[model samples]
Target: MVLQRPAAPDFVKRVFTAEEPDLVWAGDMTEIVTEEGRLYLATVIDLFSRRLLGYPMGARHDADLVVAALNMAAATRGGDVRGGIFHSDRLNSPSTRPGSSPGPAAGWASPSPWAGSARASTTPSARRSTAY
Candidate 1:
């Protein structure tokens, strides 16, 4: 698919920061309706650089929409987020709440198993820690 640039492209600049570019990454899903009202686009953006990493355009939104976006980002990042943070706002959508994805956590149905936050430090991990 060919991506068209807006009339004004000179204003675009990189917004990466130490936290976002190196330590944290972000993803969020939002929908838009076309003027014809015949199409919908659910887009996922990377907050680090304001980049559109993935999007699923269709008449309606679905779980695969968000998952596909994450898949794209994962592929771009080699699916390895060791010591990195993947952050997102709370999932309040019907597709993200409880009983959604046959998973143990209601809000966490992403492909990365350790992507979610831990309630306690007791969560088992064989990796060694560095004390500050």
Candidate 2:
């Protein structure tokens, strides 16, 4: 059986700018090749400061990995990410699934805070870097 992914919300609307820190954030995952094996890296960044708020490397690119990064980001900001709009590619993970919640403690409201398309252009230039 074939399953279709839900549509992503157009919250950011291609606007990747923020006046202050924590106002806007973006996250994405990438695959890395090493002699040992492949690794997945998830990251969260602040649009205003262009600072890497959270980044976690793991063997699988799933919701857990994304959550870890987000949690780390929240911890970095003193565990309060309220009012922050986190935008990310349409990751086919439970954490980003429409109507799904990343949990209350995740600091994000229900329905998740994910946005943007899989298209590279939809992501910010800074996040396009392959380098960790």
Q: How accurate is candidate 1 locally (lDDT)?
A: 0.41
Q: How close is candidate 1 to the true structure, as a TM-score?
A: 0.49
Give the per-residue lDDT digits (tens) of candidate 1, residues 1-132: 332222222111233333364244455555666687754444445556666655555554444554454445444655543544444444555555534533212223334322232121121122221210
* TM-scores for every predicted model: 0.49, 0.72
Tell me the number of clashing residue pairs for each predicted model: 0, 0
- For model 2, residues 1-132, the per-residue Cα lDDT tens digits are 334445556567888888898888788888899999989888989889989988889877566666677667777887656567777877665444544533222344434334452222121211122222
* Model 1 clash number: 0
Once fitted onto the true fold, the runs of candidate 1 whose alpha carbons sit more than 4 angstroms away are 1-17, 20-22, 35-47, 102-132
lDDT, candidate 1, at 85: 40
In model 1, what is the error at residue 13, expressed in angstroms? 25
